[model samples]
Target: MNLLAQTTNRVPWQRLTTAYGRGTDIPRLMETGQYEEIANLIEHQSTLWQATPWALLILLRELAKQKPDKVSSKEVQLYLAVASAITVDHMDSQDTVGTMNELLDEKYLWPEDEDEDELLWEEEEPPGYAKEAFFSYYYFSYLLLKDAIPIYTAIMNGNDKLAPAIRELLLLLEPEGVSE
Candidate 1:
């Protein structure tokens, strides 16, 4: 199956909502399946929308499916953009990731059309179970990339624009011989 189809078919889009509206719109652009709108849709104010991983996982799974010899520069950079978003958005433990994680786990908090401003305090104190569910899935995304380091290095070799982002990801990873 194609990456866009794989993601849409697997992830329950109706149950997911972006700040703008329902997540149904994601597929219209993703049909191209070529890293169309990561910069605009996934992160805002330096935070990944809780809904991002649905789109992200499609790209990720596609990359994970590639052999290193077949990886292209665009594909590598697309992965970099995704990984960099994860790193930059998660950069400060107390800020971006912390807040986005909190939101991802929030299963039942939606504002009425009139209460547009109420989302602030609700996010600050999500129910405990929400936090648990969010982290469980968020960390799992790293597991998906364990074998893709070579892909990252390949992108770094030819693209200087992504060096800092690549370094941030490398630092988060355990070194080859280290044990946790």
Candidate 2:
């Protein structure tokens, strides 16, 4: 079974925040493989959102399911975009990771959305949970992306152009004191 199918219903996408607003549109966008739209909503301005991890996970899983020769260039481009988004230096800082881990221990206070038709918060200022949501989203996405190094290797093995970049991205994800 597809990981997307497994979590699509379980994750309260409507309640989760994205770069745009709510992640309510993620599933629909994903169904059509709209990589550009998905990337924009999940990681606008290089900031990862609450929906980023799920979107990345599903994309990786979908890539893993396909034969290397059968994978489309668009899909590979999306993979490259995701790798760049997660491995950016600032996002991997010790301070940021520590804060994300600390927040992970506390129960998340999801923002309430009384009206599904209306926006969750004003564009000028997001709700308080916004920061917490970013931390949580980034943390989980980092972990998920780190674990996906093997998948990255497998996908890029024979591809001369992308393999080196994937290796560099994977190096960034490696834990301290460990080298591979």
Candidate 3:
């Protein structure tokens, strides 16, 4: 199944807008690589709609299609940076946390093994579900990059709440030499 298609199909195309104008008009903007419009309109202060990530994802896809040579991983890094900044601000609200929790569960990607019979201190086998969930936040999202931002912030700023998982996200984006 095409995940991007699945997500975009659910969008209320008429309701979403960007810096250049409505998201429906993205195709027009993409002809010229409306990069600025995407950067400006995709974000709403520190909040991002589910459409936001989808928009950037679309932009990346379009860029690849139009001129694959012009596309760069920087686009991915920059988009995440912007979304990550806003996600930090949104993290202050319980609503974001609640939404995050619900999504994690719904996605069947929750990291923890909730069965009480499982010992809390037990050392489980390698590569458990938590390992998978750690990676999921980097790839999946219907709520924009909200789930990614705070976890990234936590990893970057050492928030500790989602430290291990967020650290996993950071590793995906981190430069090889930056470890020093």
Candidate 4:
């Protein structure tokens, strides 16, 4: 099925529209099934995917404190594994892809509501290797979130330290660096 039909069929079109902005029929646009465009929109919309290195490190630190359990522990470990892979992949390709600064400038973030012409100037030109690295990073990061939400919901419902720990970890991963 088309992405738009899938998204609308799964989520309320109104809520998706409100969150993503109006006039642009995201669901309709996604009907093309072009993975790259879908990826761009996902990266642009989600702060979690764009988290800084330090923020991700802090999240790992907090997650380290949590006790091992059947579900949440496994999920957290899975996320960390994926994150580590992305990091390793980035590092290995550093020579060809240039530094993280270059990758961040080119492939990391997406533009906000702006005209194509304006976006052209604002967007960085990523090398082929850099684009590949980013695509790997984005795909795994997205999968991690998909795994986290259910665990988060369960933690929230339970009266355990797990919820608070996860909340702290998420706070650490917030867009703005942690406050002093």
Candidate 5:
């Protein structure tokens, strides 16, 4: 399906875009570099809780569509795990240990039967630089994924007011040494 058609067919996308366009001043906030303000608006006006799941699903669905043969089952599992970790449950639940364990297990492109903690800690200690690099990569990935939906919707709707700020943020989050 075409990109627009694929986007419109998803209920979550429709709801998120509708709520954002009508209730949130994304354009103004983006234009002004008021990320905190925009975040507050999203928290109050948009169905953000619902949108997170929908966004992850949409990303995986799009990936599947683009490369159905290459998108392995392990990748899908990892996507779901990462999405779960970033969702509301992360804050509300006491089972973070179990949840994070699940996340580590699924995140590997190749599924490993061993426990994640074993690989992360029990094995030889990873160099400090490696750990720092891993943390940086994960942090930037989270930021991009979290911000992608709003930015994309804003641009698609001709909301140029926020475009420059969004582009700036995207640039900042882009991996080191990578050119926009």
Candidate 6:
């Protein structure tokens, strides 16, 4: 399926939670290209939601289509910067993988064992769904955005005007070298 179709159909958006509440409004916002609102919904006070990474995946895919240029609006640039900042904030400290393992050990959500789509779309969500969502925030955000490193690198190399925002983004994408 195409990216657009995946954006609309890949996940149970409503069963997901955002900063404010359920992500039922997310699909409509995405369809309308309401990115600023989307940013706000995904991250708030530097806290990421279950919907953050999914929404961000779609947003970055759209951004990847654009050629880097000086003409992109401040709102677009700001949103990119904010998204990168919040994502890195988690990457720097959160032990998402470990926490997720613990959640699984506790029988929180069986994303690893069950079909994720089926688990996400269940008529009644599992009891630990909300907590799992909370703990998985950083994990999914890091996992999804890590794949967009090349896209961010290309945009950064193509346009100097976006350097600051793109630099912040790369901090998340480009791994730091460790001293032996």
Candidate 5 minimal-lDDT segment of 10 residues: 10-19
Q: Tell me the TM-score of model 4.
A: 0.28
**lDDT, candidates in the order shown:** 0.46, 0.60, 0.40, 0.35, 0.34, 0.57
Model 4 residue pairs with clashes: none
* TM-score (C-alpha, index-matched) for candidate 5: 0.24
Report the C-alpha lDDT of model 5 over 10-29, residue by residue, as the tens digit.
Answer: 23222222123322244454
- Comparison by TM-score, 2 against 5, better one: 2
Runs with alpha carbons beyond 4 Å of true place in candidate 4: 1-74, 77-130, 139-147, 177-180
The candidate with the higher lDDT, 1 or 3, is 1
Worst 10 residues of 6 by lDDT: 1-10
TM-score of each: 0.49, 0.66, 0.38, 0.28, 0.24, 0.61
State how far residue 10 of model 5 sits from its true place (Å).
21
Q: Which stretches of candidate 1 lie over 4 Å from their true place?
A: 1-9, 33-36, 64-129, 133-138, 145-147, 154-180
Q: Compared with the true structure, what per-residue lDDT tens digits does model 3 show for residues 10-99?
A: 433333323333456555654665556555555545344333544655554443343323443344444544444342223233323233
Residue pairs whose backbone atoms clash in candidate 6: none
Q: How many residue pairs clash in each candidate?
A: 0, 0, 2, 0, 0, 0
Top-scoring candidate (lDDT)? 2
Q: By how many angstroms RMSD does model 2 differ from the true structure? A: 6.0
Over 1-180, each residue of candidate 1 has an lDDT whose tens digit, in order, gives 132223232444444544454455676756655454543555444344445666666656566555545545554444444444444223223322333234333353333232443454356643222544344333433433434566566655545766566555555544332223
* Native-to-model Cα distance after best TM-score fit, residue 127 in candidate 5, in Å: 20
Could you give the candidate ranking by lDDT, starting with the highest? 2, 6, 1, 3, 4, 5
Over 1-180, each residue of candidate 6 has an lDDT whose tens digit, in order, gives 122223343555655566676677988987777767877888777667666666766766677787777325443553453445443335443434443224223343334333465455564755345644455666555655666666667767887877767676656454451111
Pairs of residues at least 3 apart in sequence or in different chains that clash in candidate 3? 18-41, 19-41
